[model samples]
Target: MRPPIDSGTVLITGACSRIGRELARQLARRARTLVLVAHQKEPLEELRDELLASNPTLGVAVEKCDLSHPDEVDALLDSLHRHLIQVDVLVNNAEQGEFGLYEQQRWPHIHQMLRANVSAPMLLTHRLLRRMVERGRGGILNIGSGGGRLYIPGMAVYAGTRHFLEGFTESLRLELVGTGVVVTRVEPGPVAVDAHAPPSWMSISAVRCAREALEGFERASPLVYPGLAYRWMMRLVSLMPRPLMRATGMMAAKKLRQGTALLEERGQRVLLAGGPEALSR
Candidate 1:
């Protein structure tokens, strides 16, 4: 069920960031051509250069497209068509998330997140999948989140989008079962980027996550939970009843609200003690 990797043309969105960059780096050695899509032009160019320096024969095309806009996504597709690059694999890795109470979140940001996390992927898939089906060989790798499985009070929209992806990818995989167009969803918990370390049990490095994700996609696995400890923990969580899961989420939400209240109190104390200047710092 493995889709063609070696000598394939792979298109990866958010190619300048952590997991996306790492996926590009790892895939460069095996993929014949790579279409690296990102919003930042400088970083995308830099990544393309780095990939070329290591593998001179590899074909790297840097595309600057903001996934928050449907027009930009369309333009990206048009550019690929003009360049005559037929993508053999697609990695939907770009996403946006805002952490706060849904009511407190700004509408613009929420809309951006909706477009980036949900609309863009769906549009890209709708546009590219038919060609893949006609070609009879391709792969789609969807980057999802653990939040899709659990309820979180602060990240309502973000979690909802992930849940959409979880269902979309699984259903798409079933539909494409014998088409040789593999579909896989990699659900990762919190990931560590740069020098910021994450809890050993709940997170993993972006590089490791990307590597495992690619491995899972190659095997055409319907779902992949990255990180050793996180995978086992999710397995345990999956066995819980819906009621217990909701209770656990409620407890976590309560703790978060308490923590926020404490922080607000501390800030208010500082403001009252030394005026607004003290709280500014």
Candidate 2:
């Protein structure tokens, strides 16, 4: 079933980030009310103001909540209930990824990734899906990564979390078959996040990614692989045998280790020390 985007009150988590912000911008012209949820209060407020500036008739509510914490998730839900705001659409886009060798990665970063990438989305879906089922109309969009299906070297934990997301979304879509709720998981390849770095031939702009995501959601596609070249590449990757993939991953891991050693020799931080942009690809 098509989601009621034309007039629905959409709740978008991680609304201040790239894909989330783009989704909000496109939905602003259609969705009745946008509840922007994110960790930073200033960014969410800024996004709300900018969205309203472009869409004067639109209603926007900025909520500050860190999805890495379960108690904060409950607080967010309570705030929604207290305000009597019924979320007709839920977009689970909040994510945290740390790129490093599995043994060298910090426990805190891994825990945060587990909570934000897996636990938070599951909690939000569980809380809001019941009302959607009862109302007989709603949509759930999960923004995941191609790494979920592919073997990535430095992002072991991040990739594992994404794999769980893909599995959970697929299973949930099956269960919601007759419930009149739409579920879509968008698996995007390398997305252009930094302007200073030269664009990769395989990477797509964030705008294109968001546009393709919505197209897939509206079509009720169970899974969406955005970007033409990337889509074809994933298709080819899917055809690869597990042993070959493992061998390929081994090569990549060796390169990553070499890069880390070379950079450390020059007294420089690791490649992904910058942030998720490295592993986000």
Candidate 3:
């Protein structure tokens, strides 16, 4: 069954950024109301203004919230409650990740990643799911990543969290099968959000990704791979044996380790030549 996108209020986290912004822009013409949640107020307001300019009748609310903090998420929900805005659709789109060796990552940064990528979505779902169930109509669109399916050495923690979402979304879909609350996960490959081209075979523009994701969610598809080329590639990869997948991943892991070694060597030379202060600089 298709989600009631054209009928109810949709709550979108990370509503100020690339995919989130595009989703809000597109959904403005569809959803009766849009609740835009982000870490900063200014960008969210800017987006809201832009949306209002195009669709003057659309109801838009901007909520500044850092999803990594539980208190902030709670406050955000409270604020929504006070406004008498019940969410009919939930888009768990906010995510943060550090691209480096797991050991080199700071504890605080790692914790924040976990909170944003995993804890925040889980908590939001828990708080809002009951209302959706009671209302007998709702939608959950999880913006996941291809990293959830593959083994990546450098992005250990980030990949792990995506895997959690992959599993969680799939199981949740099964549980809510008969219920009107439709759930779908969109696992996109690299998305080219900037002028600089990403070095990948499976990359699509953020606008296209958002459009495809929404289409899939509305159709109540279990999983969506955004790009056409990337979808085919992932379909092929899924058929590969586990050992073969691991072996292919090992190649990437080796290259990352080699790059780390070269960086260490350069750091050592700088330390010896110009002292600790120079190295820091």
Considering every candidate listed, which one attains the maximal lDDT?
A: 2
What's the distance in Å from true for residue 180, model 1? 1.2
Lowest summed lDDT across 10 adjacent residues in model 3 is found at: 270-279
Clash counts for all predictions: 0, 0, 0
Better of 1 and 3 by TM-score: 3
Cα lDDT tens digits, model 1, 32-126, are 99999988999999999999999999999999999999999999999999999999999999887766556656788889889999999999999
Candidate closest to the true structure, highest TM-score: 2
TM-score of 3: 0.92
lDDT of 3 by residue, 204-230 (tens): 777888899999998899999998889
TM-score ranking from best candidate downward: 2, 3, 1
lDDT of 2 by residue, 40-98 (tens): 99999999999999999999989999999999999999999999999999999888887
Backbone clash pairs for candidate 2 read none
Residue 204 miss distance in model 1 (angstroms): 2.0
lDDT scores in order = 0.85, 0.88, 0.86
Lowest-sum lDDT 10-residue window in model 2:
271-280
Candidate 2 lDDT: 0.88
